[model samples]
Target chain A: MSTLTSHRTRPPAQPETLRARRLPAYAAPAIAVAALALAAAIVYGAGIGGPVLVIVLGALLYLVGLFAAANAVEGRRAARNRTWSALIHSAFVLAVLPLVSVVWTLVSKGAQRLDADFFLTSMNNIGARDPNGGAYHAIIGTLEQVGIAVLITVPLGLLCAIYIVEYGRGKFAFAIRFFVDVMTGIPSIVSGLFVLAFWVLIVSPWFNDGRPSFSGFAAALALAVLMLPTIVRSTEEMLRLVPAPLREGAYALGVPKWKTILRVVLPTALPGIVTGVMLSIARAAGETAPVLLIAGGGAAINFNPFENNQSSLSLYVYQQAGSASKYAPDRAWTAALTLVALVLILTIAAKLLARRNRLSR
Target chain B: MGETPHRSADAGTGGTRVTQSHEWPAGASARVAEAPVSTRSPDGSGLGGGGALPRARAFGAERAFHGLTLAAGTTVLVIIVAIAIFLIAKAIPALRANTASFWTFEGWFPNDNPPTFGIGALAFGTVLTAVLALVMAVPVAMGIALYLSHYAPRRLGNALGFLIDLLAAVPSVVFGLWGRDYLIGPVTDFSGWLNKYFGWIPIFGGDGPYGNSILLGSLVLAIMVLPIITSLTREVFLQTPTANEEAALALGATRWEMLRTAVLPYGRPGIIAAVMLGLGRALGETIALALTLGATYSISFNLLESGGNTIAANIANRFAEANDTGRGALIASGLVLFAITLIVNIIARAIIYRRREFTESAA
Candidate 1:
């Protein structure tokens, strides 16, 4: 490594007078203030037709003046650091600003209509400008559809996790992992198409009836496919963390393998497993594409997922997003807010449950 | 010594030989419980051991339960695989009997009669948008991760990390909503400005009054995926050895140089995995693309033009309206998307596993 040359050896002696030291220290802040003033001036001048030469000349003079002051106050190292910090901070601000703006816009746009009525009523048979309508039916459909998905995914994911973590060892284990990896990456839309084809070709061909076009059950199947991998992967990690001694003790006690897994291993990993399932629920709760394809978008309250078209909150948002009517668009924004709130609630509940389980254990 | 009675029982009978060789745990209670009298009669006649009938019944039940759990696990794996294969089989018609090859054809107008649909445009749109999203997201994500892991004051970093987790939980549809009304409109205006000023550049050329361009879609995707990359990268960055950073700092290097030398190199594998995860999300992204991308079917290299559509977006947009043949074709496109995403995820998992192996071996 190259040896560093100390500034102490080469530099002039430190200023003994208070004025010299204080002046340089004060100069940095002063230059910063002047730089802001010049920027403001340039912006103001640009707002109007400028005397082009004067404006350009003024900007150059201001920059040079500030540069000299900055050099006087701060060493080159500090100046460069500040410049870099500003740049990084600006980029961060840029990233955050859009997100904050979106939230602000949503609140401003959607808050006027968000109320008890919005959550309790449906837009059933409402025309384009029906202001009385809400997303109750869509919310119900979303809950039922995602609820079924949770039911289907949790058991399958848990069982898969059990196998992979507890029983897996050889080629069978490798194959399972490979397939889960594949399923993990399947697009939401593909799952929707899979459900659609399953209903249309495989199930319908035997029944000889019009294909099951729009139902919460169909939406659930699609979402289950989407949610299964997340739940499995997370639960697998949780299961793996369960201490090996517990399994060994159970085995030594003559407990059956399945009994040991169910009683000892599962209890240890239960909190994390529940958290995984809850996260998967939150994930599927807002999925739009599969529901849009399988559960046709409409306005109706159908508690039975086995029959008829079911519109979810997400699909409702989509429907109103593109509608020309102002009410429709406003309703869309409110639905978005509603969806965000529900998801937030679920996330908090999941965390609470996980913490409770951890404390109890 | 306590298992002596059961051990003799296990050794005595040739007819019960299978149980002797079987590797049941030799715990005393278990051996005593499991060592059994052979039934010379199907009736309750051969009682050489105490409570042999009850033990046999209980053991049988336990074995059945074990068998059931294993079967259930394998069944889930089978179901997922079966579903994928079944869908591909159902979508096989598009492969066998399309006018144009699905991979090479440019047009994606599946709704039109005679249905000329190819996935080239969709593929291009999908890969380009995802890659661009990665490019835009990864650096900022890494910076945020490093800041949270190393630079930010402790409480501030924790708070920011919490906020980032909250961002991750925000529904994709909400992001779509945010993108559609809030982001796309301004982005379109920005694109117009780019076209006005930097029109000489090929990338910034093309007139798009509505901001549903590839760039807009990519921006939305980048935003949606930032939290994942950030969280993963933060974990990786935090795992970097403190001594490495201290050594660099001891050499009188600036903070940036310290990070560049110590933190980044150590987290290379993690950053790669994080990028891959982000890529996976980008590949499967539906709602944001659906909302932001102008749902047109033309393929152009120009990002400014609003004609490109991703496979996910196309499947989402047309699946409901598609006829049987059209539905088949859309599913076929989904199969392609699924394959690409699957490969990406597999590679990511492999890298993660390899890293784990390395760390374990080193330890």
Candidate 2:
């Protein structure tokens, strides 16, 4: 046994232990800075382009330089890995650019008109030349339309989700789930067109002296269609997250199935449901095509959604953007900022609620 | 009949019966012990007597609630069917009135005396722009997704991912306004550069006019879709089993190689689904494309030229002034758009469903 052990050679001296030599922590940032400087010099010296061009050229140069340097220092596989890592990180940076630009532009352009008058008054008497028009009327129209849409969709969407999570079985349930997914992908404009064809052209003519009229109610209907799938899908996810043991526990105590769902399941999923509803509401409030098609953007403060023309903030932005008035641009920007603010607030709130739910659970 | 004596014994000595049952012969005695309680209280009421318990009222509220939820579920199906039916109904009259072939003709003159219109150019532009957007978006989105899923620190990844989702919530009209007002200048400059450098390429070949071209529209679309693809693909990549990933790494694979062997293969279906969903979104985008495209009716491949039109954009552009037949024509175009998006979405869903089954079975 000792002779056999001695005869087994010592594994060829271990071959440098497969050393994985990593680049220093400062390597990437140093390389990026040098690349940018080189790109800027070349671009400026050649009189080729501006800051945007320099940035693009710099990013390209950085990627190439990173690959080459890594390939030279490390072997090909490690270089390839580093190159991909750099590409991925840069890709993220690239995406952040547009978001930053968009938010910056919105704020800088929108703040010029963010006054109390912009929120309190309507655009009714403000002429094209006047820069005094506000989105108050549009804001009101948006609230009423979104409110009515929420009223119609929430109960229906909740019940559908409950049905799917609690009692769903076989092909019918599958079909419902599938169609709900399909409906979620329906374009906002098509929903508007559906409302226009069914309600405005066919049904509303009966009420409005043989003439079709646009109303906020039509917009609400369209928004409801848009909101339904989102709410249903979200609520379904939240409901499914409810544990089976909770339901069984209630059942063991002589509680009926419906009561178990109502008392145990729904209350547990309530925060998530609210999050979904808020998200859907945010989406509905930002929709322009449907509102433009059905609400018939009007300047006046129309309180009754069922009656005449009403303009939403989204429609107001679109109209103001398209209008020939020079002052209209400011109003459009301001209205857009308002719309975005409203949407972002709702989205952030929903996300916060969702996060809280995850922690508590 | 053989179990009756055992059942009576079980009932007489409830606590002791449980202990004795374990000691008894394997199957028959245990069955006999359990049978009387199960048979007597089918609903598991736990009542001791053999006498029947009084039944409650026929669960009227439960039945009512079930019916209400079922009706709500049914309503979604009804709404989908109604949309298609109503669209077809509205489109038929305009189609009948068309002097031109709806499939082949390029120009839209639906308001003319004979009312000639077609979806040829609109459909072409729609497909072209959406394809271009996906081509530009998918790679970068995959990269971003990989960064979030595999590269960034967990907390940072989560925060950045949340920010990206908020980007999705930004309204299309806001994108439209920004694209038209702010992005047009930079896009025009880039188009000129492309024309100067890559004029031999058919897509980049165009004359002086460049702003509001298909290139601009597609760029906006790419940005708009970037967040969606990134978020979805990140989710999919994160779902790649750590075991598979670690196995590749343990086999002396580089980070990229490990991802290629494990994460990429696992996420192929998900990536395809995400791309198709993005395509559907780009196809049906109305206001953004409406504002970005030059609103010309041509099926040219010169993306840098200021000439492109999509069905959704055409409908949004012409709907306000459309007469009876023109409205029908626009509705017909919208129906066409709807059909295209429906096909894309269904294909995406199919891929997702199949992948789900595969994963579930594997798991």
Candidate 3:
């Protein structure tokens, strides 16, 4: 209300005049005292064990001090604003705290053994007694499995999205949308069970019997199933956004519709397509259930998708963490952190690529 | 037609001006007639000409490409359908062979001489935990979405949204570990208080050690799903038509009233979609449930003390250890979960479709 009054009284060019008229420039010390008290409470909480009652009291006092400070500085309205802002900041902090704690725990514990050997050697010959085992085979399996999944899903998903957005008219589009919606919500374990039951029991019962069973191809197929829906939805939106004017211009030059969609539309929408694909990749990279069910944990480093047992980072984390050995479990924490780091790296890479493309073009 | 005069007072100079001799409105029709007909058609000989050959060839190629794209897309659909059919077929013999009821039985001791399995406990636990999560999550999630969309400063909101998105993308296993190491310890005390105060209610009537219980599992799930609902609701609310909000404000409505009247109604379908999306994540969640729910199979309604198990968690826990029959039983349970999610998504799509129709008709 005071702001409105001052705005009406003051000229437009002199905005500072309104601030000077409405707000008294005082009460800075109250804010400082509140901050000091908050700092003291944090330090005391860090140093000493307190009764829940005392802690609650401290928190209440801290909030009251903040309210009083804001009220002194600006008035009841500013105090309310400060309170709401504090609540929002608290909510944001609450949302982030668990994640921060998890990452902190992983990095601190994982940093102990993330040496050169951790990435180079394999745990194939290492026993439960050994403390220096590594996960090279698992790392390799993760990459190959994810790469194969990407290879299978990208073109299929992209083409399907193109069909839906560009060529789809009515009934066929509705059917496709329904199926995609159904597929999106299917459980991860269902995909796993689907692959396992189909491949192991029904399709080729004898395929993995004589041979050591782990195969990257099986894992890749499962992840591909999980990734397809996300890819299609995202890519379809990107393709749909490619302006009709570009296609019409191409048509005016006697270019084929397919050629126009391919040459002009896709090029315009390439960055979004890449972003969608990368998001799928990021999602697929961390999946543990389907990979576990399909890709039987292999010990040795086998990069070939068709070959015997290969392990992924997720499976490796599960394997080690679930094992009886203390050292392997510790290493599992490290491996888990390494996997998180790898996924984060890929995400950052995708963002950078998208950014570069956007800027350059 | 190409021989028509190209010059007009307006076109030649690229300006709209009236001459002393020509009144503007009167000359409009004259200018339209004086425009060259050749400029109207970009194609040579505009229509019904031998030049149509190139156009026909382009159309043919396009048609073939369309066919190819359709075939390619159908291949993906075929793969998905084939996988589902193959699994159902493989599991059918086991499902049919069992003489006992598969869903009513509370036990899931598949490793015994004779497998006795049912989805009673799993289904109960799944629904209970997911409901618990939804109850805890929806208000805070919507609040955050509203704050970020309407209240927070733009830069702050964007930064917060990015941070939340990153948090949402954190792996489930990490959340599981975090829940076990951090949340469980703190939440146990809170759960104990709930039991103490609300024990009259059957849901909270349990013993003190609620550390690895359904309530804790739900809490973990709630935290994990918060970002998803928040981001989605933010988008939905952001897409609310601006004119409606302005109209409400113009009619002497408060900010809250404007949001209640204009923004939320416009975003109803989106909110449903967002909720379903969160529910989908909650339904399929495994690792977090595994860590917090303690993998106990019980049919109790009590949430605070007893350990519970969701279908996804049960399958993950038992799949590798189960023999053929046991695996089949778990797969059957998975089939039930699949049907539930499929139904949910279908309903969500229907709501979105109805929203589209409603908006179009209203317009």
Candidate 4:
């Protein structure tokens, strides 16, 4: 055979295939199906209490089967790759389940109380048993509280950002940036407690007849505290993005520095600043704990934010959810829906604006 | 006019140059350079080439504005310190009369004659629920992050990423209601199944009633935290250099292998920071856990039981009905929560600080 091969200019055949072997795509699905079927039989026949067991067992069994089949048919490397892919896909599926389920439940249950009456009439004279009451007062409370928060937070946050990006340097700047980061992590409840201690307890007593009182203004202060750090951080990011050439050009134009900042820097960064402010507004608007603590949720309408109790949509939801009345759940669900809608709208607007800015650039 | 150039030029030097313009090295030359422009425009406001020269004031609108911003910036630090001081000042009276150990007692009946409250149970529940949430969330978040950053097609990745971000915007109270009503049934069933199969473990050890269990609360918390962890980790994973990934691929590495060698190693610190941030949020979460947890203030390790309570939740639940002493107790507990979150966030910030160039430049 060697002599004939030499004469024919050919060599002996190799025993193995040249390329690395790969299992067919169908192999994984087949194994997974087999594993899942076996899992169902074991779980159901073994008197498992619920579907959770079945799903968990099926997933585990499928993973094992895929890895084992791939290892045997292909190799360890391919098995690892397949396992990771399966894990990643399953993780995404798992996350999507809760997200979709929550949204679906909100829409389905919230629709029960999504009437015009729900928006128009306040619970001014309604009894506990009445279902005709609305969130009109709560809406007003939220708007004013959140509006005040935006007012306080925007100027201070923008100024803090300006100090950081324009005038700040060294330890003081570092300190400001660091504190802003720390402030962002403050609990909303803690912020509420702060306002409770400082504003409602200490300051309000000084104003009132030596009695601690709750008010929408106190809630606004707490929300402002919560919102300030967020606005500062986001505004700082946007301000940093303003190109240096623009600032230098303004300087070269002999424009006063403050005028340049007010006219050029601010106008250039206004859209992003507005986006940050709106997002903070949405966040402040949904704060339940702070308003609950400070405003002391009201049953009747209260237009004045300066004094007396007020209800926000979030506080209304919490109060209603905890009430023993039959119709309270519907109101609670609808309030939740409205809050979600409000927040999503603001968030969507901000994202769209950011996207527009990006596209135009 | 004389002081403006000195202040603007190399303001970092910290010199008192209001009266002495020639003190700055660049100030003299800058004034010299401006001589021609002023001469050409003799009617300009500065000298007006007229009799009345502008006052050489020590500060102007620019300096005042700078000082104003600096003061505004310092308000963050002031507010933070004020929160701590006022909370302590308020909490001291409650601590002075506590019948129970503040750190060790397991009950929270603070409205009594000699007020009795302790953070042990609340703190335990807070840490347990937050840790459980982290355990449940971090791996799934990482997987989603990796998928979005590396595996999925770009357009699909962008869409899913955007949707995930929208998940972050959903308020906690909405999540609370959803969890309490809709998620309760499935979670109860799941907890029952877990107890049946894994009852030996303390975490899964519970009998029939399991609707508002720690498992449910932690799962809800996980959902609340998922978007944050996912987005942060996605940002980090995306920042992994393309060259390193390509090098791994050139070495005949599989996609998973490349990720292991390149992406994961690069994103490790960032992932840690993200996880810490998620942990912080989970700890501070109030309304969601307040609704989902059964509000049972018992210090036990059984997660499958219909019993759990957190400090923030306790504050929200008890504050409305609390007496003055009770309010103080709640504030004290809030102080504890504040400390925990502060430590976590500081650690996170420190981790991110080390990589500041990476983050700031990306901004």
Query: Each candidate's lDDT (Cα)?
Result: 0.75, 0.86, 0.73, 0.85
Best model number under DockQ: 4
Query: Interface RMSD values for the candidates, listed in order?
Result: 5.8, 8.3, 9.2, 4.6
lDDT of each residue in B1-80, candidate 1, tens digit only = 11112222233433432222223344334544554534444453443543222233434545565455567567657766
lDDT (10s digit) by residue, model 2, range A1-361: 8876765555655555567666778888899999999999999999877888888898999889888888887878988998888788888888888878888999999999999999999999888788787999999999999999999999999999988877677899999999999998999999999999999999999989999999999999999999999999999999888877776666444354566678788999999999999999999999999888889899999999998999999999999999999999999999999999999999999989988996235
lDDT per residue, candidate 2, B1-363, as tens digits? 111122222334444211211232332332334333323334443444332211222344556677789999999999999999999999999999999999989899999999999899999999999999999999999999999989999999998889888988999999889999999998998899889879999889968698989999999989888888888898899989999999999999989999899999998888888888788788888899998999988779998989799988898899988999999999899899889888888888988899889977987
Off by over 4 Å in 4: A1-18, A358-361, B1-56, B357-363
| Per-model root-mean-square deviation over C-alphas | 7.1, 7.6, 10.1, 5.7
User: Alpha-carbon error at A313 in model 1, in Å?
Assistant: 1.2
Instruction: Give me the runs in candidate 1 sitting further than 4 Å from their true place.
Output: A1-88, A204-210, A355-361, B1-62, B76-80, B95-97, B247-253
Alpha carbon deviation, residue A316, candidate 4 (Å): 1.0
Stronger candidate by lDDT (1 vs 4) = 4
Model 4 agreement with the true structure over B1-363: per-residue lDDT tens digits: 111243343433433322222222331333334322312333432322221112223465656787899899889889999999999999999999899999999899899987888999999999999999999999999999998988899999989988888788888998898899889998887787788779988878868589998889999999999998998899889888889999999999988999999899788878888888788889999999999998987899898889999999999888878998999999999999999999889888887787766756753
* lDDT (Cα, tens digit) per residue for candidate 3, span A7-97: 7888678666546122234443454456556656764667532355344445556567767766775567566655655555455555566
- Candidate 1 local accuracy as lDDT? 0.75
3 or 4: which has the higher TM-score? 4
> Which residue ranges in model 2 land beyond 4 Å of their true spot?
A1-55, A358-361, B1-59
DockQ-wise, the better of 2 and 3 is: 2
Estimate how well candidate 4 is docked, as a DockQ score: 0.51
Consecutive 10-residue window with the lowest summed lDDT within model 4 chain A: A10-19
Q: Candidate 4: global Cα-lDDT?
A: 0.85
Docking class of 4: medium
lDDT of 4 by residue, A1-361 (tens): 8987695675536535766788887887787788878888997798864466677788999999889888998799989998999999899898889989999989998999999999998877877878788899999999989988888888999999998888887888998899898888898999999999999989999889999889999999999999999999988988877777777666554454666678778888888888888888878888898998999788878899988899999998988888788898899999899989998899889888887664125
Docking class of 1: acceptable
